[model samples]
Target chain A: MKTKGSILTHKPSRRQVLAYGGATMLSTPFISRAWAAPVEINMLAWYGHGEPDIVSEFEAANNVKFKPKYYAGGDNMLGLIAQSPPGTYDVILSDGEFVQQLNAAGYIEELNAADYPFDDMLYGDFQKFPGHWKDGKLYSMMVRFGHLGVSYNKNAISAEEAMSYSCFWKPEVKGKVGHFDWHLPSLGMMSLYDGNGAGLWDLSGSQWKKVQATTLSLRPQVGGYFDYGGTFNSLKNGEMQAMCGIGDWITGVLEKDGAPVGSVVPKEGGIQWTESYCIGKGSEKAEIVKKFIQYMLSPAGQVKSAKMAAYPGFAITKSGRAKLIEVDRKEAKRTGQIDGMANDPITLVKEGRIHYRNIPVQQSLEDWNDFWSEYKNA
Target chain B: MPVSGKRTQSALVETTPKRLLSHLLTFKNAVRLPIIIWQALFFIAPLMFMVAMSFFIVRNYRMTEAFEMKNWLKMMGRDYFWDSYGLTIGLATLATLVVMTVAFPAAYTLAFKVSENTRRWAVFLLIIPFFTSYLVRIFSWYVILAESGVINAMLGYIGLGPYIMLNTKFGTIVGYMTLTLPLVIILQTLSLANIDRSLVEAAHNLGCRPWRTVFRIVLPLARTGLIIAAVFCFILSFGDFVSPYYLGGSKPPTLPILIVDTVKSGQQWPRAAVVAVVMMVTLFIVAFGGIAAAYRRRVR
Candidate 1:
């Protein structure tokens, strides 16, 4: 144009037009980046009574957004993780066996100890990687752990009768016993009843064969095998004479409902499972993730989580254990088992009664699948 | 030849190709081409992938690259798989029969007997249950059937004592019926409404008894709707995860529930996929066959 504005208003030559288009294309991404915002962290957790509140607190405390996905069971969460792209979740909460599998698959990143400010606050035993973690690089930190035991209808069975695994296998309870549908814990109890004890893990050849035989023997007597919530309902309604069940459901929901149910830590110790928090290997916000983990391990998080009937993963934090004992005392007093609440992890492990430690993947799968198939068919 | 006639012939030949090209590039047809391509790409491709994956082995939780017959072989051999399949098919069939029996009369009453104003409210009532969460509806059945629940509580008042129905196959079947009954009645009602009243009058005028008139005329005409309703009930009952899961005791896990457990345990993806694929194929065959049969009868 005669002036600069007039010149710009004129129709551009082909070369000039091409140059302007190239400039716009080159600058568009930069302009978009300038407006880009913080990435939202998505989380998936099991359906726990207190988990929703915990997630909300985490979101508010960090000034970060969280979208929580709930699942009916831990396996559902693991299945989701198995299918999703790595780092699709910034954080995941999983049970002990699943955490081990994730670590082995390299789907989880090793947490740098330095990033967690509250590591020293944890107890020595809790800090020791529970076989899933190795060396100094932690793969997962225990968020909660609980015992698996049997719950029986007190009106149907005596407290002393319910204290042993043999009670579930008794011929009298045929078509009346309820077992956890899961293999490891159910078969683990069977192995204990087979006189294997913690040595079940060390069994091979004919010794393992004996344990398998023991499971088959009990199969006929077993009325049903149930998952977590369903087991409690069955026990409460007296549909099952006795059930191999989790302590949480027995102590928390059933007892709270005033159901005449009693639980036991079998002479052969029951299985203990821990739920843990771990960062995915490909998470972009590793620092923030570590901060989140540290916060969960803090005393406040431990106590809040404990009140919901889950044992805090950190052994040094006595809050959860203390709360559990108090609740247990109340339950025992009501049920007239004054000393029943005395059973704890340390005592169980010290008594050489624990069945298996750090169950290997291959053996757990083989044993669980074989036992489940037999149990279902029987 | 005259110059003008020769020129006109050359011009006509030149324009023919261009006119054909313009016709081929019509806006409407061009737009429709992408939609057809997209349907094939997005809709048809995933189904093909699932069908192909069903034939392959999955190792280490990943579907293997090579084709294998292990999944199919394992499915055929496993008693657990067959038992669940048999249970699913039997339960589905029984539920379908029950639904048809109940829905026909209810639908007829709504279609012919009810006032138009009441008919709307009746249809509204039939569809209202669907607005609630499916899980909530199924769980409500537990309250009705539980040992200490409503049914047993009522029985107890009459000195019959509490009865256990909450964790049995019967309980699951009843729950499945409740979940499917509404859909069956609503669909059959729509079908009944479309029937020409003249046909029923003609059958009656021809000296047909009331029951005979209904059985011979109304039912035959409503065959398409009945088939559709059966298919809906069967599929819903067969694939039901919640009803069987919540209500069926551990003694007999449904096919969907079993697939869930297998996948969750993380030891048997290949097996789970096989179960899923079998369910899908069974559903597909039943649905298509039923539709085809209905179509044939309709055309005749």
Candidate 2:
């Protein structure tokens, strides 16, 4: 009796079957569309103290959210872009050379100049890429800029020795010199010693050979190759007598540790790298991203970022520079380091004590790579 | 009897497809699908992409659609790549051999000679180093090995001049030993734990000395574990980027450091990728060979 009753109710209602089918069709498309959100942006940058705040502020102000991805350095940033899908990021920060690379690869979109109104505010040199940009259309905007130079341990090396590029390769500095593990800067310095005169981008075949030979010659005098963190720690502990490092970090180290550290731009000058922010080509929200870039370049934004210890890309508005000076003085007074901001590029270059010029992107990268390889294996 | 046979046949016929479906639905088989998919997605796909990319020339920082062997050719011509490869392999091999040699004796003592409570503490001590970040450990070694660091500072107190060890191959070797030793000991101990204690006792009763008992009975039984541990130590020390980058001085840059510098400085991705693939393949071969050798020894 029970089996027969169950068989009688086994046939399903048409309305119930139709409702189930409709729900499946509706939910499948709805779920797929939910996975594709419109108001999200992916931002890739090297890790920095100010990045988290900037991202959060932008997200809140625009009523949109961003996922920030951080890489260790410029190379890693480029490697990630290479491996990732085209639209994986909406914004990316990289150095000048990589900006050119990205533009050439069509991985970046031409920034809308009309939307970003800070064109006149940038340093003249920052407006154009000597080799990579063409036809007066800019591919990237400068986010931050700084000079690369030597930092010395005040306890171990004399201030006079610290001022000269020759101190890096001195016999007494053997097992004490800490050069950047990077090839371009180290070999570029070597090129200067070989009489290429800091214009590493313009070195001829003979000069290039001389640079290579000089680097190999200096290998014995070299102590260790260091990245940002290691170089700073080694300098602080007096393990490294002298090192090739960024000017900003040197200033920061002195301010933090009150360690007697001095930086020099050297007689032959040094390389200046500009960290540029560009909109990714695959970004669906290019207009909004461009607006964010514009805001970053504004005086208010630039000053805010600069006060946090990052160098501003735009020429500091007179007021902004004054504010920066005030900040520096306050920092100096607190740390007891009297000459913290004296390595400003404008002053250094005006005094004829240091020189810096744009490095050709492709040639410089190739030269740097070649020099590094030889430097390591030699 | 005929009715019984017919009923059995009908039962067999009825359950044939159901039995096949149940076999397919077993827990082991159900889990295998996801594991296979994971392996393909995580390992096989990326490797295939890397190999394909290695054959292409990068133009303007983008791989061209055209296929070429220019990267491979350039790599072959470059002496630096070969030199780095040789140095990396040599250093890794030396470090692996040293680690195994030191770990075996230490593991033996911990396994057989120590009391149970002491053995637990010893194993705990072995793993304590791993609690710190790898970079911090490597940096700590610099403070220990540098000319003006603790060791030299102590030496100076005894009237000896500063001992320069930090940037030398010796410093790197010492650091590698510190890095790999703990792991080797832990793995070997786990392997040694499963050994039958009566065998060692029997060997001792048979008049074999302690050392002979270790080599003849204990080590052979734990051969598989030793090989696995050695493989780990070898791969780790061989492919180590941070240790050499921090501790190794100018003259002998290890392969990973060189690869990193090349890629970063020049945007020489192709050449860097080639070096990376070489290191990866070397590690794979060593890992597989070590396991195979252990398996052969075990079978014998």
Candidate 3:
């Protein structure tokens, strides 16, 4: 019993055990914290929605990390969700137009309406955003939106001239008009220009042809078609006198940087691009994600959206708009966030000068895309 | 006992070559297996998947497995696809010609006119551009090529007008040159520097002009490398999306851009695959043709 191996197997006395237990208990919090892994929440969103600028504060407060998978188009967003496992994403920040598709595919969870602040919404449309709810149940929550209209170089095109979509064809700006290369918004603008009004996307066959004809006619004026970066650079540098299919979402950044660029909801009306948050269908972190969406809809979150560094959108809630005005009155004023301002986006919507950017009602998206490709080739 | 021993010896004698052959094959396979596995896993498998995906259909933005030519028929039926095809071929061919022509003199200087140290330094400097992102390099050109940018400002100083350059076919070519020129120069220099000095000396001793010596002696010997370099440039330019979209403004839309548009529109990856397959076929034909022409010897 007293052999060399017996020394290795010796048990601790009661006093020794108590002392050891006390030391271990004293260090437990530090040891556990040192080893504790932060929870990971996967977010599928547009480029800036999940970036540190928007999510870092929330991350630090919640002991969670966001892993963002960003996409450029609604179709792209849908494609990504389809390819992934059911619970791969904990949250999805989708373009409002694609929320319907996401819901139709059953990729998102049915959210409780009571969790979000629908009563605080600045616009009535935000209370029941089209396609965000099904059969009296909420699915996605609208957070921010921007209008797509004629974005222009203020130095070249007078504000009055830029008011109408016909200014895109001005003889002076010939070979200087640029398109923001997505087919939907650009063709939608063309539809509005052709006086399709609220039925911009729900075109009759003849109206669709007319929209195509109008876009083709502008081909000679188009210097180039550009993505976001190109559109920004061209306008900032005065290479493009006018741009179609974009608005303050782009030019607002440039204007802040002393670029003589501005975007206006033209006389032909404009299209609204909204972005919203939804919990993924099978996310185990649905409660936390729901909290995050509520946070995004909060005054602080709305302020963040309004002042998002990547590209700004209007604050959707009344309290959020008030917070933006209080904190950054200059920005709020510049973007026409004040209630009675001439370019107030809410007023534009109220006046029926803004239509939600939607997929085509009569024609398939591919048909519009096909015609777009044809237009570019023309 | 002697007859039985002879039969056993005869059987062993017959089996010896076959055993050696098996051992030899095992050794050879050991040497070749890694590369075979690599090509099969990375290249053949993906290519097969791509071919299969092209036949599959997309429903609700999700790809479902099927064997059909619907995507092919749809893509091929579109006029824009053909237009994009012509534009892509034309632009790539133009870029290849321009790169080859522009790179030759610089390569010649580096090969023959410069000291060895200078040539080494030049090659090193040429390679430095690759350390930075190609998209960054393309963006930098905006500061130099924009309407109010450096070149235009300089043009304005001499009373010439500002010209539109940044988003034109000309701009696309410039971007392509930025991408391919350095590699082309290094290639041409290597090919030219490896020429037999004695042959060039002999041509010169016969009172051949310097330019004539280059044409008569230098070019033929470097033909293989030079042709290969041009082929590389063509391939790079043909598949490029950034240059055409960012610099060329995607006015007529190249095949690569068209592929992107096709995918972005309705998540029609099958249709995009159709475009991709066409591109791959064209590239394969061009590469094979180029190689055949490159190594072909002139019969005396």
Candidate 4:
């Protein structure tokens, strides 16, 4: 009689052959790893962090690939690094204020200030910027910079009225205001509006309470919190009369689309915004990151970055500035914000009117978020 | 030395182990082993790790070897933690109830009262929304429900003026209802279809009315399906982060969003893990208790 061993010895089953085939298919990726794709560098950044064509060309020239990721806020960036293993990121496009936080966690690599052309490559005091420097070593390079103020529809509110911070809580403008979702700068704007001399970064306990109360008070009339695209959509659709913390990027892009949006620096003051490029600590492709940064600091990169998706570049470098055909000076004058020609980062830092953002301690940041949540709960 | 004879004896002994291996790799076991491995690796392992992490305290953004009950202790003291937890459960239950109530009738119509062509078209329409991305769908609703969006614009046409709907609890509920409807309907339809038509005819022959037949005979048979559908709906709504984040507009926050807010600090993941454990435990207790009570009634 036929038995199991005799049958097995006679022929291998089709099922067995298929199982081995499936295993081989599953292992193909690992087996092919020795002949991997081109060199790839991952970048964590904000919206429109790079020009598509330029990025592609840079990849082609260096025989590498671009892997870009975006984050909404500085704290959000820190949160990503916190959750990931060390060396997961090769570079990050982050806010300058977060340099301290990055340095504290040893997330960013320290750079030699002498390696690059700082004087012509950066604006006044932007070269060896105090906020971005520690122990006489530069940790990051500032690329995009602006002030956090208000953006309003010209049809809904007068330009002069929008210039005053009180317009946010005024009865006539009630229920027409919107806020960006980022708490740090938005909270800073609130402090300035409330005339808190304690400043935005280090608020006194009483000022903190006052700020909380003000946020709560505004909640009833405030429309909703929004991101960059959401804020623009609301403005275009007439869903919001005004939004907080809109810069040239917000209004300039909308204006170019033929939407009548205007940005204003209120009477009290506005918080300054800065974006920096940081080399991640323990990056595997250190040389690629260096080359990318070097190319980005050049006029070719600066010009490309400024016009990256309607976020017009007001380049810091003299060479970068030479590439701009139009500064939109007339619109800047009308809006009462920064003009491309005259504004310098150093003067803004020296002036007490502008608040310098600080990297938040964990507990304090959590407290701030909780306070915002409470205000929303109201 | 007569080593050839000795080799044959040893080979015969080794064949015994080969027979065991062959028994283990039979067709049924071969297929099932992959599923067992997958569930163990993906589901059970992470859950175990999370539960283990919750028992430890997070310091300076990293977990320490030191054990602490402080996270558990602190969770009890926070009122919002409890509030967020309750809201998540309540909203999920609310959404599930609404879905079941609405979907059961629709499913009944589709399964019992419709022509084949009609059923096909209806199912197609139900599935059409899934063709688009969920985020896109949610954002589309954001536009339609805005203060100046389509709904208000319609109301404006009738001189009703504008009514705010976009960033409220009502908006969030509506979003969840819309998102979870298709899943609930499809599940209940499958359940309803499997119910023997003979039961309905028996009830009718016994002079039972349509409503009575449905309530007493058909639904009783479809009880398992109803439970499955409701459970799926509850989990989806309870763990939902998008609708509440975009439409809830800061009010009526849910537990998942709270978990995210807590974990967004990066160092506070252990704290978030504690919240997750509590949520899982509470849901498990409620679900199992309901099932047990149902089983007791059947036994009686």
The most accurate candidate by DockQ is 3
Candidate 2 global Cα RMSD:
10.4
How far in Å is the alpha carbon of A311 misplaced in model 1?
A: 8.0
Provide the global lDDT of candidate 2 against the true structure: 0.70
DockQ of 2: 0.33
Cα lDDT of model 4 by residue, A1-378, tens digit: 855577546776899989989999999977766456778788888767744754877876676777877777776788777667888889888887877788888898887677566878544667866468887878888776766677788887888888877777767666668777666777777778888632466677777778777777777778776667667777777777888766666877787778878775676777767778889999988778877887777777766666667465456676665544345435433333243433343344455556655544323776886666555445
> Per-residue alpha-carbon lDDT of model 3 for A32-83, expressed as tens digits?
8767787899999888888888999998878789999988888888889888
- DockQ list for all candidates: 0.24, 0.33, 0.74, 0.22
Question: For model 1, what is the C-alpha lDDT against the true structure?
Answer: 0.70
Residue A44, candidate 2: Cα error in Å is 3.9
Q: Which docking category, incorrect, acceptable, medium or high, applies to candidate 1?
A: acceptable
For the predicted complex of model 1, DockQ is: 0.24
- Candidate 3 per-residue C-alpha lDDT over B137-243 given as tens digits, one digit per residue, 9 for 90 to 100: 99999999999899999999999879999789999999899899999999999999998889999999999999999887899888988999999999999999999
- Summarize candidate 1's per-residue lDDT along A274-360 as a digit string, tens digits: 767788779897778778777666655654565444222223345434443455545424432222336655556446554423453
- Residue B250 lDDT, candidate 4, scale 0-100: 42
Which residue pairs collide, candidate 3? none
> How do the residues B1-300 of candidate 2 rate in per-residue lDDT, one tens digit apiece?
356888889888877887878877896777898989999999999887777767766655455544677777877778887887888889999999999998888998888888889989999999999999987888788778776788888988899968777667777788788789999999998899889999989999999998898899998989888999999999889888877776776346788887676566435666677777887788889988998988984445
Model 4 chain B lowest lDDT segment of ten: B291-300
lDDT of 1 by residue, B69-125 (tens): 876786688787788788889888888888889888999999989988887899899
Prediction-by-prediction clash tally: 1, 0, 0, 1
Segments in model 3 whose C-alpha atoms lie over 4 Å from true places:
A1-35, B1-29
| lDDT for residue A56 in candidate 1, whole number 0-100 | 59
How large is the C-alpha RMSD of every model relative to the true structure? 10.4, 10.4, 5.5, 12.5
